[model samples]
Target: MRSRRDDVDDAAAVERALRLGLVGMGEATDERAERRLDRFIAAPDGAFVWTRDGDGAAYVGRITGPWRRDEDGAAVDLVNVRDCDWVTEPVDPGLIPAAVAQTFARGGRNFQQTHPGDVEAQTQTLWLRLAS
Candidate 1:
């Protein structure tokens, strides 16, 4: 469900909207959104996250700080954000794991955990390579 208060970037505003049923969401939808938000908030520091920009440039980063509402991010519709140490270069498409590539191809707004045991192993290997 699209937030009715999309223009309001603060977490408080978003919470208010959700709690007040102002976003035109059914109970189940609101619960799902809350769960997603809670997961994001609970993500530990140093966890890796992969994302793509509007132009489809892929990036990977390690979360460096807790989640917060950043008004500056409103322009990109990413008000709820965490500080991250993003890799300086865009991830080379060829190096992206099949699982991750598929995830990106599917395209969803919320963050999702990449799956399959092999994908985790592949990501660790890639992370080590990038570190060196």
Candidate 2:
């Protein structure tokens, strides 16, 4: 059995990871995925949440729209963008725009009601490939 010291060390490591700005998605199972999804929805000021991919590279994104439940599962407005600070030099996180979030909310509502499957709707989902 692991000692108390070992448990403390593990907790410290997880804290450091979160401070490094990457939230742990402990194993990519359906339960964890749903939990992470809830977290994205809970982020204050609509900041993007970063998570490690299968290859150990981190990706950043935010929920650009409201959550909707379909036959497959629940889907939300997803904007897969690079953390601007990581892409460039680090800067103050507070400088990020709150206005941009409104645009995302409007887009998501309009898309869901009017054009659920339009080809141009793909543009609504932004995907930026970050440089390693």
Candidate 3:
């Protein structure tokens, strides 16, 4: 799998996002999206998890925060955090803070994580960066 996939003018789109410091869901999964961008899909319960397998996604990534859908689109409340697969919804680029935006920009990572559900097409998954 590649790093990321952007069907549109990704270079330009990412550039714009960098200048503004934000991202969009559509842009989240386009080209090598699944490999690059991963998120935690919370269950109906209040609890949340990281690994897509052990808990959420087995051997996938970590879960960041809660899920909230609003004018900004689907979004997750990310606290003072770093290095983990965060929750996501449709989001407004402007709503995202610069620091969080920077985290997303950083690419090329892999970690010991789990995969959620079975081998499905759209299983709630999160991105993982392997540790050295």
Name the top lDDT candidate: 1
In model 3, the runs with Cα more than 4 Å from the true position are 1-7, 27-132
Which tens-of-lDDT digit does each residue in 52-87 have in candidate 3?
111111222233344332233212211112223333
Candidate 1 similarity to native, TM-score: 0.71
Residue-pair clashes per prediction, in order, are: 0, 0, 30
For candidate 1, lDDT tens digit of each residue in 1-132? 123344533344333333322211211147677787777778788777776543566656667777676564344344566666666666788988899899878755555678865877777678778856
Whole-model lDDT per candidate: 0.58, 0.30, 0.29
lDDT of 3 at 5: 33
Q: Ten residues in a row with the worst lDDT in model 2?
A: 72-81
| Candidate 1, superposed: residue stretches over 4 Å from native | 1-29
Candidate with the larger lDDT of 2 and 3:
2
C-alpha RMSD of candidate 2 = 14.6
Q: Estimate each model's TM-score.
A: 0.71, 0.25, 0.21
